[model samples]
Target: MRSLVLEDFGRLTLHHEEEPHPPAGCVAVAVAYSGICGTDIHGYTGSNGRRRSGQVMGHEASGVVLSTAADVVGVSIGDRVVINPLVGCGACGACLRGQAQQCPDQSVIGVTPSSPGAYADVVIVPAGNLVALPAALSLRLAALVEPLAVAVHAIELGRPQRGEVVAVLGGGPIGQSVVLALSVLEPQARVLISEPNADRRRLCTDLGALPFDPGSTGAGAPTDLVIDAVGHPATYAAALSTTRRGSRTVVIGLHSQQVTIDAFALTTGERSLHGSYCYTPTDLRRAVDVLTTRPQQAATLVSTVVSPEESAATFDWLASPAPPAGKVLICFTDTNEPVAAHR
Candidate 1:
């Protein structure tokens, strides 16, 4: 088995390792495609701080089930599935409340140090964490279910209604997914996305979102719902200020910068603010349905696909300023299958 190991900050090395066996109640997956998440970029740049040296980092992936433990029932061998990387202790208070992503003992596959990620030929995960992909969904597109679930959860928090104006801050992979999710969940609602990058803005526009340049214009006059997908101090401020009175704002971006907001406006306006983490199993299922029903809309977000050999360079490029827009997928198997693309 081959895995991409983070040697240190800003460095990734390809290493060979023994194939992993499935543990009790777990399944071993032969990873076919893995998407490089923004969190992976942050890990590469040492911005997230959770990722450490020699860690195998990737979470968004799809693969074929190689083997399943004796205790595993729902999943079977040779089944195609998407990996939900967030694993929570079922006995935790958060888990009891159906908020497993908030579990104190939660361990994410790619982000956590102890668990190896899908950036390898094979990755093992709890059978419960696997979402079986429909026959209509391709392996390459199945890798998107994880991030799309994140978007779905964010929208669920916002609960944007018909005719309401929704604004999304950022146009990265998650941000674009947010736009796509919003379009599907609230087709009648007007959507606006603030992204400084011209390419990203163009992509958002093509996805039926009105793109706004935050540098030139503000977040478009107090939207009914504002989703801060960028997580920068400035984006947080924008999300706070641009939210209309009694409306809601959802924060999904991961940034370390401290943010300050006007307490008077928050108290006087009766607004609600939420922080969304990874999605629950329900959200992942919804994401899969969305991908299966609207494959072309989901396909538009996949901008680039590269082989495992090119992943190191792709990570470096993503760490650089103004990297290419849209999702960057890593294809583990060398097959001539035609994958969907936007451009």
Candidate 2:
């Protein structure tokens, strides 16, 4: 197996290594495609400080099952699946409630330093974390399930009403996913996207969202609901300031560690702000449904795909200023699994 290792904060080096075998209640997946997440770029740029050298840091991915331990009954060899990544101790209270992110001992496959990730030819995942893909969903588009799941969870938190106006505070992959979520789940709701980049704004517009410059006139006018996908202090303040009184706002981006909150803006308007990080089990399932049904909308977010050898340069480019508008995937071409771009 070939693994992409984080040799340093800003460098990723590929090395040949032995393939890992799955243990009890686990399965081995031959990776087809792995999406480079914003968190991965932040880690590569040494801005997140959550990733470290010698760690394998890919989480958004899809693959075909290679092998499974004896007790893995739900999935078998040759099944195409999306890696759920977030694993919880099933016996815990939070895990029992299906909120894995709140589990005291939860471990994300790529984020946890000890576990290998999908940046390699294969990844070892717990059987429970595998979401079996239907024949309708292609493996390439399936790599987006994780991030789309994040948007699904955020939308769930915001709970936008029918025909209400919703503003998304960025036009990156996650922001684009949020628009797609509304398109698939609640098409009646009008969506407005604030993005500085022309390409990103156009992508959102093609998805039936209105694109506006965040700094433009009338940009901060109150809307029924606002989702701050950028999560900077500026965007956080924008979310609060742009949402109408008694409206809801959800913050999903983690670009910065600390954001200064405006007590007056929040208190006077009586706006409710919600923090969303990852998806629950139900949200992940809906993400698969979203991709399986509205594949073309999901396909638009997959902007580029590169081979494993190109992973380093791809990471560098994404971490650089003004990266491409949408998602970039690292494809492991040697895998027998099909990696189709669209239906």
Which candidate comes out best when scored by TM-score? Answer: 2
**Clashing residue pairs, candidate 2?**
none
Assess the local accuracy of residue 166 in candidate 1 as a C-alpha lDDT between 0 and 100.
92
lDDT score of residue 158 within candidate 1:
91
Report the C-alpha lDDT of model 1 over 17-100, residue by residue, as the tens digit.
888888898988888899998888989989878899998999999988888777888776778889989999989898888788
Residue by residue across 290-342, what tens digits does model 2's lDDT show?
A: 88888987888988999888889888889878699999999885455353321
TM-score of each: 0.94, 0.95
- Stretches of candidate 2 off by over 4 Å are 214-217, 334-343
- In candidate 2, residue 308 scores what lDDT? 82
Error of 2 at 217 (Å): 4.3
What lDDT score is found at residue 317 in candidate 1?
92
User: What is candidate 1's local distance difference test score?
Assistant: 0.86
Candidate 2's clash total is 0
